[model samples]
Target: MHLELHIKSGSRSGEVIRLNEVGSQLEPSSWVKENEVIELLLRAPAKFQSATLNLYDHRVAATYVDFDENHTNFVWKPQRQKNRSLECLFINYFGLAELSVELEDEEESKVIKNFAPLEVFASKLNAQNVEDMLSYLATLGDEQLHSLFQTTKHGAGFKEGSTSPNGSLERLEHTIDKLSFLFQSLFSKPITKLLPEHRVLQASGEEDLDDSALGWLLDNLSVVEEVDDIDRAHFEFNDRMYKAHSVQVPVLKESSNLYENQVVHGFIVTLLNEADKQLTNYNRTGSLKSAFSEEMPEGYSSFFTQVNRFKKELLGNQIERCVRAIDRLKFLKHSLDKAIPVTNYILDRPILTQKAEAQQSYRGVFIEYINWFERSCPDWSVYQNLLAIKSIPTLFESYTYYRIGESLNNILNPTKKGQKPIGSLMHDIDGNEISLIREPTYWMPKNSRSNESLYINSEGKVLKSGKVKPRSSQHKYSHRCPDVVIEVRKENRPSKLIVLDAKYTYPTLAFSKYLPECTMKYVHGIHNRSNNKNLVCSMTIVHPMGDADESLQSFHSLDYSIEGSMPVSPSLQALGLQLGLSQDSDRLGETLKLLLKQAGVAIPENLQLPLFIS
Candidate 1:
């Protein structure tokens, strides 16, 4: 029997692949049966040499497939003759081809063997024809395109501790401990003030000296000279003449409750105690029986019940302890204020300094604990609402930004082979630690302006100098802010500006097309201000997705041409190129390199391999 391989799907108009020679047909004389092993030589099409052949259950590498003459032979074992198919997947490049084969019975093959004419087939893989295939792949879920993109631990810091048992909870407990210690230290010292004291002067050896002592002395003073043995009385009268003495006495102030530290400490204590009680209640009765026991959504009831049970059983006691510790911190903060004297300058300055430092340190610890709680706890809403602590989105945004930057850093300046990129923690201007940065600074050329320069004042409008004429005394200034702005400077050459914005959505075709319009707006805004059209070289939107269209494209206006693109790969190649890293450029990478070359800086050689590849 002869089997004719039919293209069922995944085939382009000009795609081609070669199979091992079998006289251009599988004849019954050499038909392979079930449980038989056969070697099939296959050659990758010229344009798809990077493609890998995927059998029903195995992947065959095609790196050695010859484009010149002979094909690469693949050993295939057929366990069953039911259904079988072959697929070719090109990496980095796009296009896929599939072939289906069915074995025919001897009687069926003999009926049409003589008159049937065989048709030969071949095709080529190119950029234009593969758009639909790429688009289709883009629509697929991430799991379906697993071979196309790679995932690395290099940039996923949040996930590092995700596997540990109650890791976030443990961290929160530790931070609480630190905060408690700091508060305890602060309250151990109290403030004291000196107050004037009025006390009646008494004879040194008076044992029963009561209110009558002063009265007796005053009575004897009137008859001082009448009595002969009046010497002691005279002395008493003189001593009584001194009346009440004024002495400085050290006294503890009652203003401890009014202090900021005390207030914060009390707040922390109340919050911790409340949380502890709630957690304990949940632990005892289960979350379903606790305050949040209201009927849940249809399908989520069981899932949420299980989650609540885990939180109550696993994290309840630990959280209770953390709350107790926070309460102790309040006592500590209060006690420290009352114990330290306000007049003891030597101890006063240091105490104030320590208090300030401890307050800040405790704040940081609480913030970290809060972050952990928000992530791990099922009833975090209670704590957040009670404490009035708001969760910041900037933290996650900052993490995303840092991961992107770190990925680029690793690609351009890798510390070690196979090292994954890590996220960075940063502090904002208000000393409130945040990861997302509206203005990020780089150590490269100091001549680079910040993203804030793109905007006008506080409004997010592009600054225009002469346009609309200045309103009265108002002056127009550029505040052109992009998410990230990098300036590359070379000796005796003008700097080049590369702008990047981070979006949490997948960079689809629609998003890709919209990015250029946004870039044009910023470019026009800048041009209106400086009248310099050559400042910005490129602008891009970075997102997380796979199988997106070519991210880089050029756009032209009356004054200047700017390149715009969206990078969806997590491997960092797109980011590295945009940041001016020089390497073998292809499409998007080429556009970035060309822009950087124009600025007169050459990127050094570095290994830019994908984190995961099939």
Candidate 2:
């Protein structure tokens, strides 16, 4: 863990923060060192925030001049000739930390390839205090701590407490980008849930009573679960924006006529008052309407009052009046009775007075806005708020894009069409966990192992067509049969199958090797008994071994293989690779990317080891 001790009160720039002392105190599983030059990743609390940083490596080596005395009893000399430009470094005593938690048998010196760069969070600003940063880091779980280390550059020396090495800098950039994106998004999402912003906007001109811009805006407020009553939505006619809302919109029913019906009347009312807004955004932005034709409709009388009764029936739904509880929605809705809340949406769009349209795509944009808002500004995590921000945001929008053109669904509109292919979840599977997920397509013919009877979907039984019933599968073979014949799509390429039946093995080679029998069992089942041709299969003994790596080595192929999670030496990459995972291009690269992102770690290049260690 690393921390920042705030020094140089006003600005961090140009402030001299020298290493005061260097030392350490070690515990069973951890240690704290002094005079260490560590780099920290930080966000300044306020504008114009800055700090002076000091660095050290050893427990008691404070002054570089002290290092000078230790080296040759010579005074430490500044490298730069100019007095002002002088920056002296104790070259002989330079140091960097290389902490390793590794295998017991391997010499710590022999483990050269470091995996992740981790940093110690030393300190930061909060409640007017310059406190210990590592103390907070201490509270974090090992995963988060591991992630912190990932943020650092492994095998690289530090200048200050939390800085990464040059080698891993690029990777660090990518990790921070992912984290920053998540943080910004999570922040925005929770913020919107905190407020009940108004939504209905007064239009300048008349459009449709149903699908018009005014109607949609008014309708939005009605179907929303917020805006409990008309009072919350509508102010006096004297107000600048004449807003009206729908009645109680049920939780899932946005298209209800009764409550939403009032929105239609509200549209006419807003249009009548704001005649300038009556024109569609198309007409408003473009020169289309003939000025002379639209002038007062040549002695037309105001029909607004006469339509009030009919509007009331539509709003009430005289056919079958239904109302939902307001208090219920308030508890869950965070607002009133609208299915989709819109106070922020209303404030966001200035289009009622501008040239924006009430297009479905535009409305969808608003829905997405709400989604983004709710995700970014989570109440629980202030560090990762995302409220309405255009900054790096995170959402499952990539899936939406993926669904646009593929075999899934033509869900996207014209504007949504894009070239970026949707990415799939790399099912880097492990353990008996695979069997836990019920197979999707293939039938899991759950039948007694004692008998070959098979059934599907609890009813439609699949029987091997014969004059008589087949004998129990267990009768011929002592082995218990799997009730399910799971199906999964093979990689769309020429492929082979290797089956390894993992088991306990105290000795080997006495029974003429489990290899041939284990290999032939599945082949015989596929060929002789089934009488089916063109089935290609290969096999290996999946017998369990004391050494997990040894078990993996026993069954190696370009095709897929499964192994139970072992007690020790479970190599993630080896398991993935040996199991025929598409690691060369897609899986390995993506795994690295995901790990880098999740770890907040980077891989820098061209950085040399620190001095003094040799």
Candidate 3:
């Protein structure tokens, strides 16, 4: 397989360079200038091992790199330098299959003559799909949900079937058992007893009576030689022999309504039926569709088969339990009446109440599970559509924010003594103290000229006459909400501010020209009059590209000078930190370390490796 590189700078400036073989020298079809940012586009036969650009065997670096729509074309910017030649530029494809490269003096010829099997890449992508689903589910704040889908151990490498923990069969069995226990615990032990009722029925000798008062009489009469009893007198009442007894007849009675029990039984039956359906669907040979509408990615047939067997065994047990429970509940409901002694009812009420509470809690969890299954899992068609429309850049931004926050916590609060980590801990920029406030809201006066004059309180709401305003106009005013804000306060120094904004766009030369304008907006918005006492030390725009010289130049060229006031000095910078689909923890840590250092934050020597090790 061969790859082609297309280079484009400004309009009318473009060249095509083809790599027929590794170590093959290629000259640009057009004149290339030194220090000029050139857009290099290459379509790889396979996915690259890393999304970042690697040049001259890692000697030179490229910026703003990413894969195009099909994930075959790689896009990035390589800025030519005075002494560096673009002759040895090569991208390493460490995908499932390996590529052979031969390096010679000044020229290395490496050709990807053989392609890795497509299934290899497909399976890996499939696993990643599962990982993403697990991550989203974890955010729902349900431990049971997490346990069900979380395959990989935290900080440990991803291993197949890690989510199952106990083998799938055992896990499914445990879940069914839990459901059964929940259902059984909902009601107290059967307390039905025969009691006297106004209505009575004649008992014949042939009739078998068990717990009824009539049955008791017949049993006693059979043992007696004569029908002489203190309270009962027997006589023939019909053509056939019949026993007429004056004894009190017993009827089954209940203390509460059976409506709730009936509803619960119905829910259990539905769940069991659904489980069986899923089991059956998965049990079929070559059926890789999961309960979720998305088809299982290729190479997971065996895994699904195992899961199906587990579900099948589990469903069998659950079905039996469910059927038996339903029968018992029906019998109790039919035999009992809603009139019983309050004292007897109270005697069993505590235990039954506890059981009912437990049942309610479990029912709630199952309901939530059902809701999540219905709403969270997309059908195959919808899933494919979503894949086509999903924004990779947006997802990358979210992950970057989390990664940056985590890295900061490890570096600044290594001991974990603080109430909250640095990333999420919002502090009052003007306040001298170092306490962290979550979702800290600032109230700006309506009369204020700029959106900078803001107020912060413990409740984050405007106070009026010792009470919060029911409707405050302060909400209409705009306030700065930077992507990441870090406030550091030293003993005798003013509070320092570090504001960062995460941009998902590629930082091309044209885009870099706007960096100064963007940085100025961030600075003025965050460091307005409300934060006059604090020093706006640094402002940065973080992206998933290489550092553009234009961005740096633009940031440095920003003017904070005023006519009559001393010029304000602040460090403005842009960082290209790639946090892509493939998790590169080392790269993340390196980027964060550089970001913090550039922002004037000191990294403790002992905290270096610990930040990314886990």
Candidate 4:
């Protein structure tokens, strides 16, 4: 099989880049800026009359124009996709063939390809991102992106791959938008519960009371103090006077009324308030009202009108009545007669578990918010088997994670091996243990003791408990899930952290500014819950740029005073560990060794291999 990749747009438009035979390693003949259009022309061997071409790792079949009996052409545009190279595959009666092209930033002038071996494609996340980004983002159109963005940010687990133009933030905004709509729908007709309340009332007359009230009157009324004169019978009891010859008296009766003070009601109330606050913050930058309508529509007042409406409903329902009743009853050391105890919803069980439309809507809203709060990304169920544009950052993260683990395995003995996606726990000769966790979500709930990290295995499932995992000090409102985290536990010392966040961009001003802020979050945001101390000792930003600034690669301290922005890329020469394109493992290991030493971790003598050993 033979292939021809040509530049269809930009400064290099109309240039034909040659392709080598299958199995040959070659650099990208040329580069194109992100989102630039390109053309792929494929020709099958003489024996084969037709051929097939697939782009985005063959997840999306490329539509081609037949040039001849054996030749075909297809146009592809890498929309809003940047950094790292993308792989293209083709097949025919001659068998399968493969080729890759690197996509560069629009501003980058250099043409050096920071290529890693194709074996890097073995990682599932790398493959999944490519398939998901391409198929779901564009071919399915904007509505799909909007849907995916909503699905990911709401209740569904976060969809892997930062495919959207704005990445996770854009997805989150989409979720908020949907939630804003949902809250409005809910508040206009809030859910209510029929609460049975007992009230003590004095019977006025036989005709003035209902059947239940009459029954209570007949059952409770009796002579209070043995009235001597039945004609003049008037008794004083509980500081209230009652006239007799069978006169009016106080009685307790139970009546059911639709009340909005149950657990589910309070939950929705809290969600509405919090959603309004978030919408306000989101509105400061982007307008929810504008997104919703050009002008205020009927029944829609403002971005947060729903919250206010619900609050207004509370006035009519008088939730305060329940509160005052409870307070009085509790103060009097009496059993609750009219007040319903407000309690939190049980998280393990489904909220409003019933088969009604309104119940389902309430439950849906509750689950969506909880999923968002938990930071669980959407699963691949929405657009599985779809084509994905290869995400350079995700690819680099996978490369760096595996490369580091590969190097560590050389120095340390494998103590424990994880299943599914296959994580590892290694121990040095000195008994110091280091564990590699990939995309582990450290749930930093307000309760520190319950704060734990769940590992997302290769199959995208959370590893069951009892497997080794990372933990962090409690966080307020949000969870932290870094791409790659290395936990180092040395003898007689607090466990230290080495966080690797892979970025696939050059050392530009924006990149520099982002690195520190991200590093600080990883450094200080995640902490040791047991000791209440910071856990991260070194936070490295792994990029793929060969011409990175020196300052980017060098370690520096930020607010927490730990090393931050230590850029590790296969392109840069760290520790003079140069071995051509394959130097990634050595370069990463040397940097990790430096961090371990700084954190007072003792690397066993034999395990600390020399730089020349590769």
210 Cα displacement, candidate 1 (Å): 12
C-alpha lDDT of residue 155 in model 3: 14
- Among these predictions, the greatest TM-score belongs to 3
Candidate 1, which segments miss by more than 4 Å at Cα? 1-400, 409-413, 416-481, 503-507, 522-533, 546-614
User: Candidate 3, residues 172-273: lDDT per residue as tens digits?
Assistant: 444455554554443444223344453355543433344565565565564323344423434333333444433335556443334334334344444445
Looking at candidate 1, the ten consecutive residues that score lowest on lDDT are 386-395
Query: What's the candidate order when arranged by decreasing TM-score?
Result: 3, 4, 1, 2
Q: Backbone collision count in every prediction?
A: 29, 92, 11, 13
lDDT by residue (tens digit), candidate 4, 215-243: 65456666233434434334444555444
Error of 3 at 74 (Å): 37
The 10-residue segment of model 2 with minimum total lDDT is: 386-395
TM agreement with the true structure for every prediction: 0.31, 0.19, 0.38, 0.32
| Ranking 1 against 4 by lDDT, winner | 4
The C-alpha local distance difference test score for the whole of candidate 4 amounts to 0.41
lDDT of 1 by residue, 441-487 (tens): 22111123333233222223332222443322122223334555445
lDDT of 1: 0.34
Candidate 2 lDDT over residue span 100-173, tens digit each: 21111112121111212111211111100111111222222222222222211121222322321111222223
RMSD, every candidate, angstroms:
24.4, 30.6, 18.4, 23.7
Of 1 and 2, which scores higher on TM-score? Answer: 1
How many Å off is the CA of 296 in candidate 4? 45
Which portions of model 3 miss their true places by more than 4 Å? 1-194, 197-396, 413-423, 426-478, 489-493, 509-511, 528-531, 546-569, 581-604, 610-614
